[model samples]
Target chain A: MIGTAQKIAIEKTKTSKITSVDFDNLPFGSVFSDHMLVCDYRNGAWEAPKIMPYQPISLDPSAKIFHYGQSVFEGMKAYRDKDHNIWLFRPEDNYKRLNVSSKRMAMPELPKEYFMEGLKTLLQLDRDWIPQSEGSSLYVRPFIFASGRGFHASPADEYKFIIATAPSGAYFSSGKVKVLIEETYSRAANGGVGFAKAGGNYAGQFYPTQLAVEKGYQQVIWTDDNAHEYIEEAGAMNIFVRIKDTLVTGPVSDRILDGITRKSILEIAREEGIPAEVRKLKVNEVVEAAKNGTLKEMFGAGTAAVVSPIAAFGYRGSDYDLPQLEKSYASRFKKRITDIQYNRSEDSFGWRFKV
Target chain B: MIGTAQKIAIEKTKTSKITSVDFDNLPFGSVFSDHMLVCDYRNGAWEAPKIMPYQPISLDPSAKIFHYGQSVFEGMKAYRDKDHNIWLFRPEDNYKRLNVSSKRMAMPELPKEYFMEGLKTLLQLDRDWIPQSEGSSLYVRPFIFASGRGFHASPADEYKFIIATAPSGAYFSSGKVKVLIEETYSRAANGGVGFAKAGGNYAGQFYPTQLAVEKGYQQVIWTDDNAHEYIEEAGAMNIFVRIKDTLVTGPVSDRILDGITRKSILEIAREEGIPAEVRKLKVNEVVEAAKNGTLKEMFGAGTAAVVSPIAAFGYRGSDYDLPQLEKSYASRFKKRITDIQYNRSEDSFGWRFKV
Candidate 1:
């Protein structure tokens, strides 16, 4: 076991691309920082962590990752405060969840020292890359992939863990997104890897989401694979439904992601005396609520977008437009979360980690 | 659209590794041939196909394949006849299914000529890598992955398609395997990418299969995710159950792979006047048949293993041993398939393609 006090080897790049980037007009994940952290798991043990220049990786053509998709990832962000102090929202949670995903994929669990020390060193080295603009942060992506060379359909003996960060603007540049209630395609099954942030889960959604995009919806709200009756997730985020004044979101199970942002919102709702319910949100119930004019709001929660409000939703060839409010729960939760992330407010939940 | 007459660029290796390999003892999917096929899809079109020396591939760390698992693959084999002529069984079917998987993963479809011409050129260059021993052949793997650099959760704009071949022995070295009927973990779900040869689908099964291995079972007989009642697949292959005299197998659906070898067996059974039924085979039905001594055999069918017989199966803490017969359907189908594959018998189905 590696200790948290272990030093991470860092090799700085000769020149940085910070000057070339337009932080004001940044895209969601197109631009990356100068340095990245890479750790390899070989011979049944993880090697020393190293922070080096962000570059392309060379792998064998028959690597298991290319054929079997033995990979998992975590999405997080680093926010810059008014005084230029960097803070991460629930970094430990991300680390723990990453291992949870790794175990489910039959990959080796990464040591905390390697993940934490390496991430901090990489972020400190590339501190200038963190955008300080409003609603802007450095989007950090930590991923692990099978690096073993073989064409066999089995678990890999070698693996690679890498952390790449991108300085980006808002996830949804538009004010609010219009989503379609998916009835044909499903995101996850009852006993599948849907709960894990596995790579294949995202790949399986591209086609169905593209169809929804063609139908004028920005994203698709995925339902259960068994019967498509219960609502599950929205795009890649955990979804929430606001019926009247109570906040209703589905419980995390083998088929739903235990999202950090989603959990934070539930806690914040409790702290603010807002009624919140964590239960299975059925599609027909939401549709009935929408038809009766009781569905107040709906939004998605994840690391990329802390809170993305859904303006309207289409289901069964009919569109249901959500009512716009002056001071909605989405806006309220977004401000509370971002305030804590940016270090502009009190950290009552101890969710902010200073770097 | 590229035509069949298009010439493929070839770069042969000066030194071959054939001299170092011991053909008598070959492992599955570990030894690679001298050359491989490579093609790139960029700017909304596929580039010219090229055959190059087998080597490592360079990709960006943020490539969609690494994080989103946008990949699909096909498994095939090349056999050497008595006259040393290379033959491919149902190669066109594999090609069509590869595209079907691509479409489901939102990937660009490879032109038939690029696939066929490139594969033949590469195989011809490494003709010596095709093992002539009994139950041995050149296992060919053709796969495509997202090569575009991005961190967004969407379909990739660029992709790479490659074909790598390996000289290997039998997939199951042991004569018969003991399988565990899975009830907790599921391989695929309804309305999911279970039918497609998606990389993630294979990755998700590794952990559960590992558990079954610990329980003295070599592989798992996967059931439906909704309810672990109906049998779907055996390991990575299509499963067939013989109850009394009639051969029974599940019909292909969105949750079951349309295996080439599986379909071929059904056709062969029809030609041989063997009773075969294509329908859903429930676990209780099989268990009842096994208790009454009506279950004679169960086998797996796929490209890697033409037919792998199962000796016993465990479900709900009880083990059921299958009766061994002097003239079993498993042995008969195995001989019939290999005879056709090695050109020892007549090719009545026109399934053989000459290179």
Candidate 2:
């Protein structure tokens, strides 16, 4: 582990591609920033970090990451305020979660100082890539993978951790999206790695989500693997339900991710004197609420999208449409969080870290 | 897709390292052959295959395989007979399963010609790597992964298929091993990717398996995710149970892999006039059989170990020890499959494909 006293070596790119990027029509994660932070773990410790030009990484064909899926990742964003100041929202949470994910994947844990210093150094060098437009930010992706040259099923002796940033617009082009209730497929099960930000959890959802897309839905609401009766999460996001005057969501468990955005929303709701409950929300109960006109709003919360409203949801053989509220919980929280992230609002919880 | 008429380009290593390997202490998948096969899928089709020295592959930092776990792999072996000839048992079956895994992971399917030619070319160039000793062979690992540069949570447009070989002795050194019936964790569930040879399926089992290992068990007999009532597979191999005079195993489902060795064992059992049944094997039924002193033996079947007999099984709170037999089914089948694999016996089913 590299302490805060150690400096990260910098390697600037010879040419800049900022002008070549179409900022107005930026795709979610297709365009990258200039520099990236890289660190390797070997000989029982993490080496010094370095910031270099974003490029391809070479790995052995028998790397355990490509064979056993021993990989974990975290998604975050760097915001640019109107006054040209940059901010990171609860970055410590991401670093802590990253170690948790590494433990579950049987990989070495990354030190807090190494993770923080690496991100800070990389972000400062590529500060210009932070988009100034509202609802747009520089998406930060930090990932680790096994790099050892063997096909053994056990953990790899060597690993590489990388931090790459991409200029992005809103994760969802359309404000409101349709979701299909996944009845046949499961994203994870009890005693599984669903709680960790592991790569396999996301990869397992593509086929089922693709099926939902063919049915005109943008995402699938994943259920518990055993019964498929309780709602766990939506595609890459923790879901929330607004029933009359209360905010309800499934409680965090080993099988459900502990999303930073989800935590912030629940904290904000309670601080604002709103009624909120965290418990198991059965699929039947939600469908019944939708039918009885008690389900006021539904949305997904994650780093990529602060809050994406669900326009409608499909269950077994039927599509239930949700009414657009005059003032929804999703809309209220999205504005409050984005404002806090951009430094336009007061920071009461000390969630903002300036860079 | 490349056709059969297209020839694979070969590039051999200038120097060989066969003498450096110790045949007496060969690890399962540690030592590699001199050459490997590579094929790329881009622009909606597979390109011509190439055989080159086994080495590292360069990929972008944001490749989907690293972030989303869009990877699949297969495990088979090449046996060297006493006559100094190599044989691949059911190689076509492995190729077909690789495509099935690719489709499930949303990766591009490799052409049959590309898959077959790549393996053959690489095997011939490094034929000496196949050890001639009994229970020693060259383990073939064919895998495919997403190579496109992006962080989007979707299927990649680019993929690479690779076939690498490693010299190996028996996958399991112990003749009979202890197994723990997994009760808490689920290997896979209905509508999950358990049936596919995807990388995540293996990764998810590591932590749980490690816990079982600490309890003095070498492997685990995974139960279904829902009720934990029905048996699935054991470790990476399909499981078989012998009760009284009948051999029974679970039928393949969306939650179980269709193992080639498992299929061949069933066929051989019928041909040898042994009673066999392929259907749902409930956990309670096996426990009941053990209590009544009717359960004779249990074993795992796969390409690596061929047939590994189980000495005991622990379920709930009690461990049931199996009695040794003078002429066990496991011993008979192990010899039969190894004989068939090494071309020491008649090619009754035309299962051997000579290299």
Candidate 3:
């Protein structure tokens, strides 16, 4: 086993591109930092982690990633406090979830030390890229793919682990998004790889989400595959529905992602004396709640958005508008989570990790 | 629209690597031919196709294919007859199916001219690499992936269409394969991408298939996700079960792949006066058939193997061995298909395409 204290090889770029970037006009994930971390797994062992200049990678045409999609990834963010101290929101959870995804995809599990040390070193080198403005941070993407040269429909023998960070603005810039409740298209199935942040899971959602977009919705609320009656996820995030005074979200199963932001929100809600239920939420229940004027709020929670509010929803050829509230649960949860992430709140839960 | 007579730029290798390759001991998909075909889709149009030396491709770390799994592929083969004439079986079907998969994955479809002209030119350039042995031929892989740069969960703006060929031995070398009937895992879900040749569809099966391998089975017969009672597919191929006299196979739906070799087998069975039925096959019916000694044969059909006979199958902690037959449908169909493919028999269905 590789030790956590293993040294990481660093190669600094001769010149940085920090001066040419427009921090205020940055897109979600377009602007990458100067340095990245790369590690190769070959001959049944991961090589030493290397932090080098961010550039294109060369891979054979027959690489398993392109042919079989044996790839997994994790999304995270590094926040900059007023005192210039960098913080990460529950990064260990992301690490564990990445391995869970890797195991499900039949890829090799990455060591904790390689992920942590490499990410920290790369972040420290590109500290200037982290946006200090409100709702802006460095979106970190750590991914692993099958770099082996073969076309067989089997697990790959070689892999590549990479960490790339991008400075980004808010995922949903200004308004709450409108989502279509998808009944015809499904995101994941039971006993499948839906819980894992596998590449195929995201790719499979593009077509259905595009149909929703064409119908004037910004995203889709994916339901269960077997029945398409129970709510599962909202686009790439875990969905929470506020009915009456209780917050209800689907329980994490083999078909739903175990989102970190989602769990944190639940913990914060309970701490604040709010009722949060993790159970199977049916779409009909939400539709009835909307019809009876009991649906107060609905939102999506993930690392990218922290919390994205849903302004309206369309279900079964009928549009339902949500009533705006002065003190909505969506805003409260977003504030509570971002406060912990940016070091503005108490450290009672020990959720913040200083780098 | 690109016409069928579009020009394809050709760049030949300065030297050949054929002399170094040991053709007798060839692996499945490890070795590649000297030339390959590459075409790019950008700005809402596919560019002209190009035939170049088989080599590695460079892409940014944030390429959508690495993170989103927006990739699809098709498998084919090139056969060399005794007179050195090259032939392809049902090439148009492969091309049409590639686009069908591309549409389902939200990828840009390749022009017919690009796929046909590019493949033909590459095969002509690497004709010497096609092994002429009894079970040896050039395996062709036509794949497309999202090459655009982004990390968002949406369809990419650019894509790459590539064709790579490898000379190899038979997929199933000599003996029949043992399979496990999966009751806990699934290959696809209803209203999912199971019908398409999407990359994620294959990757999701690796872990479950690995479990079957650990239990002494070579592959798995994946059942439906909802009930795990209906037989869907066997490993990466479409499965067929023979009970007494009638050959029964599952029909293609949103949760099952439309295999090329599978449909051809059905057609050949009908033409040969063999009873064939395409419908939903129940696992319990097969178990009953096995118990009564009426289960005669089971086989997997796909482009890679053409036909692979199953020797035994295990279900719910019970192993069942099939009776050895003097003349099995697996052998008969494989011979008939190979005869049509190699131009040794009459092309009644006009399935052979000469390059």
Candidate 4:
């Protein structure tokens, strides 16, 4: 059990213990690490944050966060090297992206120093949890919520910023995944909070994703809400498609998340002398390309699953099975990206952050 | 500080010894009452809820609620009658509205017992904060959050249900407020989380609301995202327009919140035999109605202020002032609503819930 210490005060607790989280095989979000970092905003200033043992918090049911959904979040990972030194892959991007999310959600912008220092301080203490096995890392989640009384439709006077870590393996146990192109539901809309990593945006997709799972698909690839023509993203990850020799993906807009891995993969593709293009990839064009055997490969890119190759696509109850190729682009992209992440190759893009 | 001992064991804390919050000088959510109610969604079942003294909670900052906005909340108030008895007006409506919000946002649906039992328990302990002052009541905020670990784009396995109270004064101290009609910015989209009380939906409006405030308006009335032509809700409140004595409000959709106060106002309008139309209210049509002297009164309705009459509107740098009338329709509606709320008048529609 963690000590009952307040993060803002830096006041030490009578007892500080190394708590243990039951790390038996888990099904995501079930287990947690020992210590968590928290910072509170009140009186027009952000207080000093602290790391204490993980425990349940007491909140007035009336706090603005739970009801009004004034919350935003970021996703990044801490990789464990062969030498037992902890490394973070592209953490600055996560910090910058978090602020971008904060701006879109109208939450206060958390300083990059605060994000870096908080995660560093917190992860340094929980470094044992970063698995060294391939496709394993310490997933770090940083989020902020409005914490105040009553339910007026305005900003909360108080905010709580907390960080938690989870030991996670690769997103998929299988080599490839199947996606269902969503026709009815959308992850986000134009001029909406789609690009932001706000909690509500994720919650909005659960039912549709569940429907996809029920229909024997791994995830649903969302499209633009206004027209449902332009491909947006797949579940939480950004997607890439290879038509003939050229790679095509959707452009980043208010409706699409600007994925860090998506950006990295694009950079890698160019460095490898592969044709990578970011533009409006219409659904019909991709479907036609797949039918004509021009679409050689399709995959999702995100921090969790560096490159998840899509083996098939289900649309309007019609299944389109992708042909297996001796040399696939997804395998190449995944290997190149993961190598840089684990520091197995030269760090040309300066993506690795050593802890 | 409230004892963490009572927080864990479901034992009621002794709040009688705690210093009470001054109800008279309450500045919105700054002050809280002595007790709070909470329930947990664990082991796939909601446990029996409890009410204890209000206190701080410990949580991993990376919990899904903070980052992804996997949070939903509702705002309602417990009214004090002239006879010193406490009453709740159609809390079932708020519960239903909260569920609607939950389904849309992909959070777990709170049980009716957690919604009702939690509120009753908290209000019973903190009834002292239910101000007897006119237009004042103990504001109740019931919310649910994603308490699970990690930042993956999936539904949370664990959740918390809480109810907190704050004593608030009248929504507006002086006369009717002026609002700016936002032609560009949007609150929610057809496939967005706007209809739900999701936090990100409100966060997305903060910047636009600030712009409206800078334009010398209290709130920015939203329009549809695609065309910015159809009128939606106000900043944190559902809006109403009176056209030639007919109370008009927008039809609730993916773009608008299903407010408890909005539903009640509709009931009151019907009971009084006043013509009330619920449909798509276009901004241009509203402007024409105001120019033709048919727009009688514009008001914003929610649990906090109940109903605030809007005196004028600013659109594209043009100002339109609603005529001032004696025994204004807004005053009549607010009085009738408050009368039934405070038990001063008969609740002909059986809207009042005795606690």
Ranking by lDDT: 1, 3, 2, 4
TM-score of chain B of 1: 0.99
Ranking by TM-score: 1, 3, 2, 4
What candidate 4 gets wrong by more than 4 Å, as runs, is A1-36, A49-61, A118-127, A148-150, B1-12, B17-19, B60-62
What would the per-residue lDDT of candidate 1 be over residues A1-355, giving only the tens digit for each residue? 5565246778889988899999999999989999999999999999988888999999999999999999999999998887878889999999999999999999999989888887888888889999999888999999999999888788999999999999998888797799999989888877889999999999999999999989999899998887889999985788998999999999999989999999999999999999999998899999999999999999999999789999999999999999998989999999999999999899999999988
TM agreement with the true structure for every prediction: 0.99, 0.96, 0.99, 0.90
Q: If both were scored by TM-score, which would come out higher, candidate 3 or candidate 4?
A: 3
Candidate 2 residues lying further than 4 Å off, grouped into runs, are none
Q: What lDDT score is found at residue B219 in candidate 3? A: 91
State iRMS for model 1: 0.6
Once superposed on the true structure, which residue ranges of model 1 sit more than 4 Å away at CA?
A1-6, B4-6
Descending-DockQ candidate ranking: 1, 3, 2, 4
lDDT of 4 by residue, A206-321 (tens): 87888889999989899877777877898579999999989899999887889999998889888889988889999999899888988888889988777888999987778888
Q: Scoring only the second chain, what is candidate 4's TM-score?
A: 0.93
List lDDT for all candidates, in order: 0.92, 0.88, 0.91, 0.77
lDDT of candidate 4 at residue B277, scale 0 to 100 = 95
> Candidate 3 on B1-355: residue-level lDDT in tens?
5455346788888888889999989889899989888888899998888888898999999999999999999999999999999999999999999999998899988878788888888888899998888888899999999999987778899999999999988786567789999988777878889999999998999999999989999898989999998999975789998999999999999988889899999999999999999999999999999999899999999999789888999999999998888999999999999999988999899999999
True contacts kept of each: 0.85, 0.65, 0.78, 0.71
Chain B TM-score list for all models: 0.99, 0.98, 0.98, 0.93
